[model samples]
Target: MVSSVLQWSIFMSIFSSICCLRRDYFITAEEHWWDYAPSKQNLITNDRTISDRLIQTTEYRIGSVYKKVKLKQFTDGSFRREIKPAPWMGYVGPTIKGETGDVLYVHFRNLASRPYGLHPHGVQYFKDSEGSLYMDGTSGRDKLDDTVPPGYTYTYRWSMLNTFAPTKDDENCVPVGYHPHVRSTKDIDTGVVGILLICKPGTLNPDNSRKDVDREFVLYADTVNETNSWLIDQSLNLCLNPQRCRQLFNQKNEAFITDTLMYSINGYIYGNLPDFPVYEGEKVAFYAMGLNLGLHVFGVQGQSFTFKRKRTHAVVFGIAWFQGLYMTTRNPGRWMIFCKVNYHFNRELYYRLSGMNTHCYSYCYNN
Candidate 1:
């Protein structure tokens, strides 16, 4: 049955891999030209996979650009605008010049201040003797006026998408639950850059029930100046709701248990669900938001307008059906449990549990 499932899966021409790990599955392949373009159709309907194609494409070439800069305040108190040389920005294509495609344009900006309304835009694309990767395409600032608000910093970046698709299996996406993985700088530069505004938790996208509730912690990612360019690293964790993470798994992993936690949040021993533990004896609403800029051309932010964080109000909802379980000890570690649950409001609730541990541990379970 597993073989049949694998056979029926979309075939990754650009990215291909053969599992080599015994306990955990690993797909490795030589990078190819087409691996950069991952399409929604292919991922949703085709026989091809993403990782296989990206790895295969990288064999021919690997390209990336980076820029680091400091911000300046406006004397007039309006906003600042000056495109100076970034720390570094360029393309990593084939060694041969003629072998490369047009230099993919990467633009940067900062707009994470007040909630201004803007549209979604495009992604950057580069083609060379080897192939291409689609990246950095965004819309104008969420709102396009220079009304700098207090505690707002923005960063904008751009890149290219050589192929038609938008995702590849080989791509190392920001892992959920880790903030830096999705926002901070790292060895590899992913197509995401923008300003980070230090605002009240509920200011950007707040929940009325939780608004003014300073006891909980909220973590989210947004593009600042340019539509997209994010600095991230492996050590930096990706924050994801336990329920949504479980949904990524099979049904066997979706069951719920009250005695144990389903997933970890902020590296804490808890489940990734609605109203999970934010700290000891303190549980707050947990959510996972999938932000997208929609289809773009040539990877630019002119048309950008859309951003979402799943189904919760304000497009942010809690992970309910899919869940995870984790336990910690004096020696912090993680464990996964395949469990199921009955859900209400299509959101995952919280449960507490105890486990066999020589050290003190906290747990979160859901149903």
Candidate 2:
């Protein structure tokens, strides 16, 4: 009987080793790789649902105002009406028109620092095809569509959109506010999901500056990922390219946390990239390296990182990033990087071949 028990234990050990060796290959035995691609399904809130209101009937209601402030001058001798963004918050819209339902397009700096929600004015004509519009200060990054860090050096632009229906409501839009799915509580400065635009009361044609604003700057938010199965960008690639960014998981079971790097600027969080192979209760350390545009390196002076668990599932590991000024002459500039790195799985090392987006949207924010 004792011999039989010993034999069973040995078999179990061998099975566990096999599982670890082929972890990534088998992690999705039940799901196909193409299943990770983005879906065309629109994300609408309960407020935008068919039952939310009269669907076939076009609604032309009076526009509402929450906070109205006007500024004709700035200390810098500018005729622009500029408003400062709140602490770490921002606001967009009113897309104001007078009582007649004309459209006014407005842009704000540091919108993440204000308190404006999506609001619609004028007579809105309902159509079968739906699309949504929102105010974003992060320029194109407001879409929250990319998997790369936001603080990177890139050419950025801001715009707004007024989508119709069935295609453009927030996936989680409710009566009071709308949620941009890509941003988690960790990324946002405020916990509130701001207001969403209902339809304006008319056919949505413009006359003058209001027309140009509507034509040039319709408030629009980028779509966010709806599945937990994959991230915004999940193209698997070799980590050897400095310009390539991708999501990866351990290829083995016994991996433990190894290193982390978190960098900050003026008390603002810039970036945090980690390396791993970590286990519970294990202490890992790393350096926070900063680089200027000139390629000069600066250490945090005297700071080494230690791991802390914020989630119940995965173990925290290491973080790292490169800080530098990259120069370009054109509107949309390209930055090049050189990196040589490989991965170690189950005592075997594997290198990535390339970094690619698993969805329809490539890393176009670089645009």
Candidate 3:
């Protein structure tokens, strides 16, 4: 009788462990209209004038203008379908969560017109679930899951093995990005990017929320080339009118394109970036990455951060990669976090504060 009871207990434990080892995510690829800048103002310099700024600086185009493009993004199965919605609501994809030793079963449905696939980084997938197409010398059934056509669905199985797990020094959450490989450049440039976050085992609560973190912010600093933007001509015509676009493109196409390059933080320019709210003394983590081109300098006025165990005022010379900072909100006040790069600063790659009461308005003018 004692031996039988022990065996039953062991079996129950094993079954519970197996149940915790699997995480399934339902993701859908759909087309939606994303507003790069919603606040119809110069977020960089707070300039209210529109005519002169719009003509000279491509960074100032505001309002319900700009042509609507079919940007491919990942949405949760229950996410509502909308045209131009906030970034958090399926514009930049859902924040994927998983744990070490867990298997991620992603049911991906492609609703876009083009063929696309979900290729993830820092994870393990078999050849049939690679979600990428290349000359990898594989044939027959091995490459069947490379790209999923429009109106088709494919299930990608990814394993977060211990080999690819986060290191001890890594924060509770780590970021992973996924995009389509069919037309890599155009797809990413036209906004096919989404974020995936993997957490350490037992770091997430029963409700799938991060533990011991009050607030988390992920910033993708990117320079979007207007010429390569999806529906560039249509966007220009809608924003600046047909005759004006013709004149501008004819005389100074290169300059116009250069000026139109959107230096944005999470697709928001000027001060259109949303405010980050947090209470005093809460733990905060900022995950930053630079996409596309140019150097990104992330700075938060009135606060010092700890990056890699060193104290720094800002993350200087942030390249096109991932960099993280963990800090405690000891100093209470509304602060400004902006990119220190000259062009990015001038283009309004920053976010304003609404809460807290730290008096350091000097940093705003220094930019």
Superior by TM-score: candidate 1 or candidate 3? 3
Q: Please provide, for model 2 over 150-201, each residue's C-alpha lDDT reduced to its tens digit, 9 standing for 90 to 100.
A: 2221111111213322123221111112222223321211221222222223
Candidate 1 residue-wise lDDT, 1-367, digit = tens? 3432343243322222521111111111111111111221222123334222221212211111112222222212234433221111111111000001112211112332222111112322111111111243322342221122324432222122233212333111111221112233211123221211111112222121333222322222211111122221110112134343233222323221111111212111112212222232222222221132111111001111112212211222232111111111111233221112222111111222222224344433222
- For each candidate in the order shown, give its overall lDDT on alpha carbons: 0.20, 0.20, 0.63
Candidate 2 off by > 4 Å: 1-80, 83-176, 179-182, 203-367
How does each model score on TM-score? Answer: 0.20, 0.17, 0.78
Best by lDDT: 3
Q: Taking the tens digit of each residue's C-alpha lDDT, what string does model 3 give over 227-282?
A: 56554556665543566665766576665556666676766667666666656676
Query: TM-score of model 1 relative to the true fold?
Result: 0.20
**Whole-structure CA lDDT of model 3:** 0.63
Q: Which ten residues in a row have the lowest lDDT in candidate 1?
A: 91-100
